[model samples]
Target: MSREIVLGVDGGTTAVKAVAFDLAGEIITSHHESVPVQYGRHGEAEQDMNLIWEAVADCIREVADALEPDDTVVSIGLTGQGDGAWLIDEDGEPVRPAATWLDGRAGQRVNRWMRDGRAERVLEVTGTTVFGGLFPVLMEELLEADHERASRATTQFNCKDWIRFKLTGERLTDYTEASRSYLDVRDVSGFSTELAAELGQTDLIGLLPQVRAADAPGGVLSSGAAERVGLPAGTPVGMGMIDVAVTGMGLGTVDDGQGWLILGTTGFVGTLLPEVSRRRSQNSMVLATGRGRQVLEFMAPMTGTPNLDWIRNTLGLAEVPWSEIEQRARASRPGANGVVYLPYASPGGERAPFIDTAASASWMGMSLTTTPEDVLRSVYEGVAFSLADCVRTLDMAGDLVVSGGGFRSDLVCEILADVTGQTVVRQDAPEAGARGAAVLALVSARRFPDLEAASQALACPVERFEPDADRGLIYRATKAVYLQAREAIRPVWPVMRGLRYQDSAGDQS
Candidate 1:
């Protein structure tokens, strides 16, 4: 008999990646296709649904082409960037460009909901706060603008769910993705209409599909989808999940108390919990796991990798190796000579410990002695500090497992360890999101009884970066300064936001 294969699709911010894996979770082939992000004035970020779907099809075909003719593909799983709203008509055609998770057009609505105590009810149901980038608020804004269009809408799906629907012809979303959509996480079925009514839209609840995890069987691939992607018809398709949760699974951090930090285009700090931890409230979201366990996800939505690219591109320093920058950063003393930076580059403003939509990046305490290296080091440190804030808010004091492209740089791991004062373990796998989706496919196929067992079988080991006690102490002190600066700057943020809003309104008028 030929070896059974599974295909995992990870639709990310920058690209769509497809990985083919054997029954043992070993990767067979991988492919990626870049997708363009559309940015507009007033922090609006969007993506063309048609283009994204084309990229997905291209990636899947590329991966499938690499597979041996005799190898039988058992199932397909999907995981992608979370929270963005993709509106579709009754025929499942996208009505508009998707409001990417990076977009913050719903900030005003989110703020109003939060202030009106709707956020509390949302939290109680969805296990997440009302954030501007989430699908619920975005959907609400879309509905208010055109009630007739919303009334005709059959479903509102996340990126992954939308793609899966294209393949399987099923309208469904996983628990992890649904958790971020202001749906009831406690309700195993789907969104709670009662909670939806409290947020001023009773009908919106009906737009969501049934909730399942990446490990659940979504449906078989339709003949049309199979022919388009060069896959066998009736191939099993597994339910999809949010990218971060699947990344955790891909890292094999399925055990209770095991934590993973993903520093990709965005950063997320997540850990598996036996049950929900209701103690630490702010900055954390509770999501269901692939293996039926609950996870506490603490996200520091904005980190400076994008900023690093911006600085490099704008300053014509793109050719400078990041290694050289790291070496220079190490030569400098801790704290970047009192220079601090705030990395709030996302349009949805900021989430986590502080839900400040008006927050913008800034450099403080720079002097004549400041070098480009100092600024670069501060950017690295600033991103680390944000991650530390999420850790503190969740009280997640455990072995910190790090994954994502950022971990490829040793400097990032060292800086993260020093900042958090915790040992950072780098996982062996780089494409955790794709791997996680494959793991879910395996589970749905009953290759393993659950995610935990699959994790033990598939997880690979890497070096651990332990925190330097002396450096850790220095970071502890600097963290105090960071906190103070954050508080001091809070008052000015609202005024900045008001001005920006006025300017945007004027431009529209």
Candidate 2:
């Protein structure tokens, strides 16, 4: 018998990563390529559909070729960054550039929704407050901004859905992707007409894609898809979940009350639940993962490791590697010696654990004695603190499966464990999303009955971190001060924004 593998494609915001995994969740081989996005105007982020396809196809073909001569790719699965608005004609051609989840042009609509209580109502239905980066609002924003392009569009797809359509000729999505902002997921099967009408964008009702679970068969990889991606025709494909959803499962985050955290370009802290949460927070996203379980996602749009990269560049420490930075941070003690940093410096502001569009980064208690290393260490603590706040809000006092680049740092893992007062677990697989996607495909292909069995059989944590009581006590006090600092700085954020806004107006005038 030939070795069998599944092709798991992670079509992410900045790049496409195609990984080959066996039923055991081992990474056989992988290929990756970055897909660029264009920022045309304020809040406008677009990617060429052709460019995305090229990157994904190239990665798939390359990874498949890397397999052993006798090996066969039995299935294909996909996952991508969530909430990008991808529009295409009936023929699967792009009507316009695909707007990414990071695009913020719909701020005007987001503001209106927040002001008029539409967002809170959205929280009641989908378990997530509507925002500019979501698909539904982007649909309306697209139509109002570019009627010509919007009129030509025949349907809408999220980033993963678009990639899956290109792979299997099926225009569909899964609950993990669609539940965030598009469809009503109360039943966890199809679109919610009631929620659509509530949003006043029922016109988009027809544009929504049919959603299925990750284990459901959407379609087979067609001959055309095979040729384009250098794979065998008729390869069975599964409707993959959102990146976070699949990543969570791959990390073995299935037990009730187990929280999963992803700290990539953004911060996501979520826990698996037995049922959907009726009382949702203004900043939490309740996701039905199509597995009869609900996940409460309290994501922070601006708190991430990117701030560290930016700081490294700003401080002219480009030559300093992350390993060295980690060493320096460890040499210092917890709390960074009276200096505190808030990791919300992004121009777009923050989105979760409380939606504050005017929020930005703040550095308080910095003295002349503060060194570059001190600031760097403080930044590490700052990002952890931000995620700590989210974990607190989610009330996740159980085990946490952690993933992302920041996980490479033992210090970060320790800090997170300490701050959250929970054990932090890390698996051997770095590509959690790809592992989940592969397992999901295996289930669809009947290699595994469901995600739980797959996770239990193939996944195991390599390292575990427990909170230090001494450090936890320190963080308890420090977190209170940090919370106070965040509140105190809120009023200052809009004032800072007004200066720039008034300057821009004056310039135009």
Candidate 3:
């Protein structure tokens, strides 16, 4: 018996997962470990870089330990949270706690660029609009706050690439991760020095790592990493793609026009396009795909499950179990009893359909008749509607692959199906990112010729939520109300910001 298995490790926002799979993408076993994230002054989100590595090592070890006598782990692949600057020195050691993608310390820099038309100029070359907490502006923050530490930095990589560096002892990143940063997304190649110049950070161009293609060798696992993960030292590791990019692939949504939504720490809505359409917008990223004829157009709103998590923790709903919370949502009518929630509570604001950094979440048409359940249910609908808005922008037309924590709730899936008026396919694999990483590892191991074949053979969906015609009609009206409210609140956002600022100053006095 050929005990050949490929392993994939995913470093997520709040947890790290390692999942093992056979050649046809069937799950053999999986292990998970929770990790810590620290938030400090000025919207800062940081995590200990070493803890992530240890988590990956621990999870990998757990999975490796479960292997039968003949079981042999062939190749390993990695995926992680996108964005947030992870800095390391020439020696490949972290200089400080890695800045997470959620960190907003660089909002001011983004605002400055947006105002001076510098953002527009850079977008011309990169074909990407600026987002708050992105790497280019975040790099400026590191250099400005502490030049000494910044000077020692020789290379910068995304969260996933940092882990790959430890495993393979070679620093490199794939195009998917590169496109998330300051790289030239138009051609899907290397860094755009011109974009760096517009941001007034020319030096950052050199710190970029060499670009590596997917399924290509990302150096062999070293003795140190092998010892920690209980794997052979010479095992090949492939340069993995972004978590969002792999989620669709893991679901086997490879055919042209196939699309999916990932409701993780963030809400990502994407579709596979037939051509490389380089339409530039703050809400979308145009990416070149492995198949020369296809491209990926995606938009990720900064708020997703995190927004809902806030409602539970901040609104005293934590005492009630989430299962009960789901029941409340399910009890609520389609319109949440006429109460509506805008999920733009994120400081980064809304980035889909339109880019509004100052956008604020609001409850429109709430009344004393509204119950806590109504408010909570509206939040679920609010997030789904936001993602639906983005999907409309991409024009994704097909059965939707919905994967993430939010989708675990049957109510959430029902609402997505109704709101989008499409069948929502939910897979049994909870760790879509890790499973996708396994798909990459299998490709690197030559288990199947390439990704498409591996995906078709291995990817499977266990549940399907088809749209209810009656409910779809109801949600069509519900979505209209949501959009109208969104427009109505635009002018009020500036006033809201001013009042909040004034309230802060008054409290200080």
| Per-candidate clash tally | 0, 1, 1
The TM-score obtained by model 3 is 0.93
Measured against the true structure, the TM-scores of the candidates, in listed sequence, are 0.93, 0.94, 0.93
Q: What order do candidates take by lDDT, descending?
A: 3, 2, 1
| Model 3 per-residue lDDT at 6 | 87
Clashes of 1: 0
Candidate 1 on 324-343: residue-level lDDT in tens? 75776677777878888777
- In angstroms, the error of model 2 at 448 is 1.3
Q: How accurate is candidate 3 locally (lDDT)?
A: 0.79
Cα RMSDs, all models: 2.6, 2.3, 2.4
Which candidate's TM-score is highest?
2
Off by over 4 Å in 3: 278-282, 290-294, 314-321, 494-509
Name the regions of candidate 1 deviating beyond 4 angstroms.
Answer: 146-151, 187-190, 277-279, 290-295, 499-509
Model 3 Cα shift for residue 273 (angstroms): 2.7
If both were scored by lDDT, which would come out higher, candidate 2 or candidate 3?
3
Pairs in steric clash, model 1: none
Q: Tell how far residue 187 is off in model 2, in angstroms.
A: 3.0
Q: Highest lDDT: give the candidate number.
A: 3
